[model samples]
Target: MMEERKIGRKTDLRVLKTQKAIKDAFKEMVMEMDASQITVKELSERAQIHRKTFYLHYTTIEALFEDIMKDLFQEYCRLIEQTAPDAPFDEVNRVFFTFMSRQEPYMERMVCAPSYRDFSDKLFMTMMIHNRSRYNPYANYSKEEQNVINTFLCLTSVNIYRQWVKDGKVLSLEDLIELTNRLFLHGISDVRHDL
Candidate 1:
C-alpha cells in the first residue's frame, strides 16, 4: 500500500510537469504564430513530449486553448481576490488593471489573438458568475438589464485594453487606469462638464 501511494504521487508529479511543459510551449508558439496555425505535432516537439502524451491531456488544439484561457481567467480572479478582498467593483477594477499591467506581454498577445473575442466573452461570464456579489454593478436591475449592463461593461473594458495594446501602450499604467476610470465612472460628462 505504501509503495503504491508513493508511485501514485510520483506519477501525479510527472503529469503536472508534463502539462506545464506543454502549456509553456503552447504559450511560446502562440506568441509567435496565430493559435489556429499551431499543430499538435509541433506542440509536442516543442514540449519535448510524445504525441500520445499530448493526446492524453487534450483532445484538440481548441481544447488546449480553452484550458489555457480557463487557467488565465482563474489567475485573474485570484489576483482580484488577493488584491482587494471584499472590495467594491470600482476598487476591484483598479486592482484588476494594476495586475494586468504587470502581465502586459501575455495580456497583449492574448487580447490581440484571433480567439480573443470568444475567450474574453467566456472569461467575462465566468468572472461574473464566480464573483457575482463583488463585481455585479447591476444587482438592483432586472435580469435582462443586468445582462445588457454586463455585456456593455465587458465590451467597453476589453476594447479599451485592446486599443491600449495596439497603441504600444503609450500611456503609463497609471494613466491607462485613470483613463479607464474616467470613461467608466464619469463618462463623457466629466469632459463635458469642463466645457
Candidate 2:
C-alpha cells in the first residue's frame, strides 16, 4: 500500500506530529514487549492520542510496524543503489547490516534487542520482498519456489543478524556479511558429492 494513501497529508504539522507521536509510542512499547503483544488501545494512550486518531493513521499494529520499516528500508536501499548499483545478492547483506548498525538509538533498542526478534525478522522479510525486483535472479522460479527461497534467505539472514547483535557483534560487519554469504551460497553441504 502506498504510504501517501495511508497518510492523507504530509504538509500539515499536526499530521506530522501525530505520526511521530504514534511512531515513538510504538517504539517504546516494542522495546518493552513483543510486537504481537501491543494493542492499539495501549499505544494510543501512550501516544496521548485517541484510539480513533490511531485508527485514522494505522489500521493495525503490523501496518504501523511495516510503515516504520519501509521508511528505513527505503533509506538504506537508496544508499546501496548509489554505492553498489546492481550488487549481487550476497553483497546486499553488507548494506543491510551496516544500515542496522547505524539506526538511531531508539531503533537500536527496537531492532537489536533479543525480545524483539520478530521485529528483526519482519524487517528482513520486508527487505526481501522489496529487494526482489532489484536483486533476485530467481524470478523465473515458480511462485512456491520463490516463497521457499525467500523464506530460507530471510529467516537465515535474520537469525545470523540477531545472533551477531546478541553476541555484541564479535565479528566485524564485513566478516558477518561474508559469513552469511558463504552460508547462503553453499547451504552447509559444502561437499557437493554429499548432496
> What digit string (tens of lDDT, one per residue) describes model 2 on residues 31-149?
77866688999999999999999999898887897788778778866867764445777667777777777777667666666666676577777778877866667779999999998
TM-score of 2: 0.73
Number of clashing pairs per prediction, in order? 0, 0
Question: What lDDT does model 2 reach?
Answer: 0.77
Task: Enumerate residue pairs that collide in model 1.
Answer: none
Give per-residue lDDT, candidate 1, residue 5.
100
lDDT of candidate 2 at residue 127, scale 0 to 100: 74
Off by over 4 Å in 1: 83-86, 133-135, 192-195
Residue pairs with backbone atoms closer than 3 Å in model 2 (clashes): none
**Residue 139 local lDDT, model 1:** 78
Stretches of candidate 2 exceeding 4 Å from the true structure = 1-11, 83-85, 105-122, 186-195
Least accurate 10 contiguous residues by lDDT in model 1: 83-92
List lDDT for all candidates, in order. Answer: 0.77, 0.77
